[model samples]
Target chain A: MRVSLSTLRILVLLGVFIATVLFFASQIDGYMNARLFNRISGSVAVIALIAVGQAFVVLTRNIDLSIGSVVGCTAYFTGGILMAWPDLPPVLVPVLAMAIGAAFGAFNGFLVARFRLPSIIVTLATLAIFRSILVQSSDGSSITTDRLPAWLTEFATMNAFTVGDLQVRWIVVISLLVVLTAHVFLTRFRAGRTFYAIGSNPDAAAFAGLNAARTIFLAFVISGALAGLAGFLFLSRFGNITVVAGLGLELKSVGAVVVGGVNIFGGSGNVLGVLIGAALIDLIDTSLVRWALVSEFWREAVLGLLILLAVAADTVLMRRLLRRKGGAA
Target chain B: MTWMRSWEGFLFLVLVLIYALNAWTSPVFLTVGNQINMVQLSVEKIIVALVMTFVIINGEIDLSVASVMGLAACAFGWMVQAGVPGGWAIVIALGIGLACGAFNALFIVGFGIPSLVVTLATMIAFRGFARVLVEDRGISGFPDWFNALGQRGLVGPVPLAIIMFAVLAVLAFLILQRTAFGRKVYFIGANRAVAEYSGLDVRSVKIRIFIASGTVSALAGIMFAARVGAIRGDIAQGFELDIITMVLLGGVSIFGGAGTMSGTILAILIVLALRNGMALQNITGHIQTGVLGVLLILSVMVPIIRETGSRLLARVR
Candidate 1:
């Protein structure tokens, strides 16, 4: 009959979400509601995609701070390619971006797994290194709509389906599918399950014959690849690309994953929770603009506060769980 | 230790080599005025780096230091612009830094949360706070007397800020290398549980170290504002990387329980000279940052490589 802290948190989050939606519904008309949903889904898609990858890394007790830079670099790289070859196939662009991201991730993995350097330090270096390269390569110039291929821009606006006059973008569906697949993999796959073992206690996992370093390395790679994918989505959604396109997104992904009930110290939490967490964050972000109670300037501050609160709550709940276990034993 | 035997010695040689290269290549490199200006550019960052050395040596980090510097700088500028005395504004800036550090320590030491997570959150939060406080506009136009201390020389070619850095470096070196408090920081970093069991008050030491980081960061913030004569929320953006680069490049182990003030000083000088040399050669800022990033990765990698190589050799024997 004892529900875990994570389950309790999810329930509380659901209640808050429902209340917020109801409050907004009462304040705004049905047309505005549809518009809000459309906006939320569109913004949440890229954020959720990055958050899912971050969740994988966090579940392995490693963080990929370079994710934002990877997304930025990949976006710029994609932009560069499209500008170079206006006739290039749309599908191949994403593949190229993912490959680039994977390479970056592999570099991070080698340093972390092979050298045993901390993920934070390695990714922190890569974060600057990658962004600096992007800036240097671009020479501070940005890729605008005029440079992008016509098909890619059209693909950005293509609708997946309409539900009662509410049109959902194809990008949202793609992000949702990503979430579903990641959820199943985390729940069922042996490789995914090994992440928890490594995250919770790498020494114990190593003793049990798990290649903790390799697993952690793979986590970083997956995170990187997903970030690249997210970059593709970012490019399609926003045609204008700057050198700082994905700046501070690593913070956003970490915030989403932690808020989704995945422990910041790693191990535990689900993708479904991350989906909800991403939605909540984007909702708050947009709401700041809509409500005008607080300025949009406070978005980063709020994200930070959310992370701190979530971690603090998790810590207290975990201690309680431990105390209860000790009492029963 | 022999000159060639220590990391500081290695850094010294690198410094000399860079000096030689710069001297041979750039016409302005060897002048006393230019050299002073070169060292002056990094004084604030080096000040922050000195405290960061202690934080890293204690097996903790405060990513919020740069943000703290920004916020404090902005606050000082705002206060001075609002007609508060410059000296009082500096005090207020340092106070803000102290509060910021205490906030980090409370969550980290009191709540028993990881310093990384705590500082990461504060880093974002504090920067956001700075943005909200100053918005997009920058504050400037400080008094002549205040500007003189940070931007000009008090003692013939030695800017007041440089003197401050030197005095602080010596103090940090003494405290870290000579005092009981310094020894305890190392003990706690090496093994926190063991240190705690021995009743060395690990939490207090961590709190003190974090506070020192905040205070020093604030001092740097005030100095930076004086030199630049402007304060923006974005001041010191990405400076955490440079400060960390210096600490790591100085041979300070990111893992904690290792590093020295002298190593950090030499590393700071090397970076300052390298930056100056690059500027003289007309290298762009982004390229400089890229080089530093590569240097940071290599700084941590080389030691690990050496250790592993030694282990492999031992196993082979």
Candidate 2:
């Protein structure tokens, strides 16, 4: 029955989200053609999947910079596999990519769990390592899937009710799947709740007899797996796989995760909030493009602005709440 | 024994071994002109890594240094475009870089924001700002005489940049070692809470380090502009990875609190020589990233591996 402050903030962001959607829709006729809209939404969908994975990592108050590289590795591997055997069912691409992604994730897990190395450093190193794999494997070229399997085409196409007022790519469907699943996992599942508790206060979690290292490792696994799925979706949407395909993605995912009200210090956010954050970031980028900021640099500026606003808002609200309760943070 | 266990010691071994190998493989490896060229190229990165040593030591990372250089380089371009004297342009660019660096410090310190978060934001913003200023057009066209910073020598075979590098490195070394503030930074980075409890001004210390990082990165930017005689947004793109790799390779811990200027200098040389040697031997650019990636991985892995192995033996016993 209680509307918590965070819940209220989420509601406000949703409302802002709707308004931004309308603003873009109105400009749809003039600037964003159906083709452009489809492209933008599709890329956003792909990015959102990765962002959700990143949100999970950040949820435990850790980070994984290797998501972009994971995406690159997965996408490249999937694309490369498909290229090698064109007749093989494209449906298996996700499974194959997910397996590769899981391996990378497990390695990240091993480094963090066994060594107690900081997540950022471990992930950063792997970002380079995984990306280099794609580069070396591809020999500085891209592998394009010949054609989408029929089922994949069905999964990839996005539209309003499929009748076609506004064409939404199938990426939107997958993004929702990732988001909803993550949301349920974070809020309802035991491991998910444990992750939050661990992130909020690792020592407290340990004192409560939680296996902090294992939980962190699991978090990384989930993050990597989701990134792998996002990579599949990336290939399903963009046929070409380049060495730099997911380059700079880690930072963007961090931006979306943090901006969505996820605490950088770990714990205290949910997937639903992250989805909203991801949508908002996508909306901002699209709107900027519609406004004719053809120079791609402004995109970075917008991202920085969003990160600052979100962090400032989260920190201020949290501090105020603590102050009002007359307690130390 | 401690010294031998240090980054300097490790890098020294790498350098000696690499140098010996290069001499054995290629007679041109140890020539004075070629070696000076390597040092000359290393000047900017060495200086920036010196300051970054303090930044990482304070438990923060700044990804914006390369971007800061891009922007600072633009300051010079803007000067020349506005018809300022060449020397004036250089001075003004350096000043602007300092200001930008200080601004980064202010944002991080004033807002109590994490350095990673703040600099990440600024990295995009500054780069974007630089892009807008340049508007996809590069500014060159400086007086030939003004180009002497990159062109002329400092008494028989030395570059002005190299001299600048040594002086700056020593000053940075003193700051990080002799100065009380430097000591506080290392203490804070090693453990912020302990340092805070010990009455160190963690906030101020971190803010100053950010500024120092920004300043040095900007100086590097100016020199890069001067060296290549151009400035653009994507000019130094992807360079952060290179600098960070060099900084980390120099013995600076990624998690912070343990490195030295001497180590950074050795790292600077090793990176330069490796690249130069590779070039002489014709290694591809893409593979070089792989090399750096492997090196980056090994650096982190080796330390963690040792700790893990030692702990494992203890646990098993």
Q: Which one wins on TM-score?
A: 1
- The TM-score of candidate 2 is 0.91
Worst 10 residues of 1 chain A by lDDT: A24-33
Per-residue lDDT of model 1, residues B88-176, tens digit only: 99999999999999999999999999999999999998988888788888888999998888887899878898788889999999999
Candidate 1 Cα errors over 4 Å, as ranges:
A1-5, A20-32, B1-3, B308-317
Residue pairs in candidate 2 whose N, alpha carbon or C atoms collide under 3 angstroms: A61-A266, A156-A170, A157-A170, A158-A168, A158-A169, A159-A168
For every model in order, what is the iRMS?
1.0, 2.2
Segments of candidate 2 deviating more than 4 angstroms: A21-39, A145-155, A158-160, A292-296, A327-329, B5-7, B301-317
Q: Which run of 10 residues does model 2 chain B get worst, by summed lDDT? A: B297-306
Model 2 is docked with a DockQ of 0.52
Q: How high is the CA lDDT of each candidate model?
A: 0.87, 0.77
Highest lDDT against the true fold, candidate: 1
The digit string of per-residue lDDT tens for model 1 on A210-316 reads 99888888988888898999998888888898988999999989988988889888878888889888888888777766654466778777878888988998888
Candidate 1 residue pairs that clash: none
Docking class of 2: medium
